[model samples]
Target: MTAVLSRGRSDAPVRSVPGRPAPRRRPTVAPTWFLLPALVVYALVVLYPSLAGSVLAFTDRSGFDPGEWVGLANFEKLLRDDAARAALTNTVAVAVVITVVQTTLGLLLALALNSAIRARNLMRTLFFAPMMLSPIIVGLLWQYIYTPGGPLDSTLEGLGLGFLTRSWLGSDGALWAIVASIIWHHVGIVMAIYLAGLQSIPPELTEAAQVDGAGAVRRFWYVTRPLLGQSTTIVIALTLTASFKLFDQMFVMTGGGPGVSTQTLSLVMYQQAFVYGEYGYGTAIALVLTMIVAAVVFVQLSITRRGEHQV
Candidate 1:
């Protein structure tokens, strides 16, 4: 017993072997500390500007000076103006179309890619390439495509479908065309998100359903869809927010032109502030837009959370 006790005491410490050094300990930064940089930047860039805009909404400040106090006047004008009303309606319609179309197409693509296919990695890269391009650049490229007698029209003519070709940017269909371009650029990201979700799902679940005599559609509906609740929430939320902030494509392609047809809230906000020099009114418009976006995100998240719990 005394010899065992002596041996235990001798081996108590982790002594390094001769000719070999101790293993190096990895250094890890605290999670809170990692967030410091982003928090500071957001405070300076987004938070401060938003607060200043809110305060300026009350006063009619035209960029240079703090002008007269006008309580609810800006909001009053915003409510009664026909242009503002039209802009709001267009904004809502475009957002809905973009959210639905983008999510559906993206989900389909994700499902297709998740299956065994030839050159799947190459296809993924090609699809995701457009998403990596600048929004402005995308707007610019689509501008040429939608231009009168441009590539789109040429392609239609070549296909003997010239009757379907028209001035996309110059007509009533301009907004939807812009939405299509946005979907093209962003649907890749949505697909990537869904692919991640599909990958995360356990193979055994699908296999079990198959063994139980469940058909393909039934298995997907009963097992896959419910499991993809979180991915659906993410795709919908991101696309909804992006739709509301619909500016770059509409701005570059149509310029809210042929009238106020394509004038989204963000586009109108820019025109009101920079083009017309109505800074206070523009700030007011921006504040309202921000609130609407925030409300949408909150409602979407809440609904999705409730659905997740129910599922």
Candidate 2:
């Protein structure tokens, strides 16, 4: 009987009586209110406008009252419009060219500036100074240089290269001229990014590679380049996004062109919305542009991330 009682006690689950006090509840966590203001502002300013604009893309709303539903007419018009097609192609081409050239030139400049030269600091300052200037200022400055009798023309003429002195911003050479301006204005930012990345690399790694009989090129290929993965990723992503959304320079410089040679998507959107009063079409273009920018950024990040994983 004692054994049976012992066994029962051992196997029995403990149960609280009905009058027993409930276990103390954990203190309720107060949600952080620090992000509230910024979140609210973002929702109001950015998110709401984006959503509203997307909705507007489907309507034939003017500045007047009573907007009518247009369905896919605006998009269909855009597809059939030769001017729109040309503008899109030009935008893509210019963006790609500028991004490639800027990235290369900036990386080269960063490498040069990283050398042990007495004038390195001065050179770095000069190189990065253009980035400090406003886009309008950059545009005006380039416009002057591209004028028929500007410094560039004079310099080329003086060097007996008169053939190279054609009107830089005129129809024949305007596209290349705009691209050149973009590269000049933005390369400094890229250089700074590369410089930062270079600074972050450990000197010991390079030294060790050198000590092991690796040549400069080999060491760079095996060490420096690999280490710069993060920086390259950042540069590419920023440059890609900036290139796709290029606007300010175009606005101030060519105003969509001598002949539509430099009419980017943003320029087109502006013309549609403000110039032609085609608000619906303009909003559709804006939405597509946003999607394109997102896609480019995503692809760049994905490629860089995969490379990083391999490293």
Candidate 3:
């Protein structure tokens, strides 16, 4: 009987049925859906307005009626008019100065903040606090400081440095003053970004370099700077875009200055649209400004991508 049972068990084989099919692949939680709300908002608020502005740029919508098509007339006038040319020149100059100065100062501040120091948090808060305030508020506040015989000048005089003070918001120096205010306002933001990048770096790498006889500057240049490519990309792109789009400070500080010396493309666009009531021309200027920004971003992106490839 035992031999017969064993034979039967052997012949029966391991009749093991498979378990329930793996739970229907708990549907891949796509992150793309997270972007839906933002995409919708952008389409409605930004994309729609930008498209409408482009259309307006092609039409001379002067009165309450439907705008008449004017084709390239606005652009032609923008190029040919001397005032427009001056505005363009001033815009480029201001943007250049703001970008260069802001980026350099921001990097320096970031490096300083990264260094070990007592009261580091307090110093960081103080440096970055200006960024939290509105640009208009910053402008107004700085205006008081820049005014002749104002707090800054008074302080200079009190310190026996009266010769260093000037009419910061008048004449040719007004543009530089405006640029300085903007830099002070924005440097904090860039510094924060740089600080984040700096902190992300592995301390071991830096320590290893130090152990290998690399000095502070050498360690930063070889280890820290090279690793900071992404941070540099972000800072440069943000600074460039912000510089070109600057308006509030300019408006509040100089109102395009003694002779339109600080009239950025944004300020010119505003003046054309609201002040001069040249809606079509203003739209054209806006379109041009958008194109310039896009071009700059594209160039930066291209350079970043190429650098990535080489790496």
Work out candidate 3's RMSD over C-alphas: 8.1
Supply every candidate's count of residue pairs whose N, Cα or C atoms clash at under 3 angstroms. 0, 0, 0
Task: Tell how far residue 137 is off in model 3, in angstroms.
Answer: 0.4
Worst 10 residues of 2 by lDDT: 1-10
TM-score winner: 2
Distance from true location, Cα of 133 in model 1, Å: 1.0
TM per prediction: 0.86, 0.88, 0.86
As for candidate 1, its clashing pairs are none
Tell me the lDDT of model 1 at 305: 66
lDDT of 2 by residue, 1-311 (tens): 11211224434544434566533434435555777888999999999988977987888876654478999877888889787898889878987898789999999999989989889999999989988999899999998888888899899989999986786777756888888988988898899998998898889989999999999899878888887888889888988888888888888888987888888898999899988888888888888888988988898798887665222
Tens-place lDDT digits, model 1, residues 70-131: 98899888998788889999999998998999999999999999999999999999898999
> What TM-score would you give candidate 1 relative to the actual structure?
0.86
lDDT of 3 at 79: 90
lDDT tens digits, residue span 196-306, model 3: 988988899999999999999999888888777788788888888887788898888888878877777888888888887889988998888889888988898778655
Question: Per-residue error at 233 for model 1, in Å?
Answer: 1.1
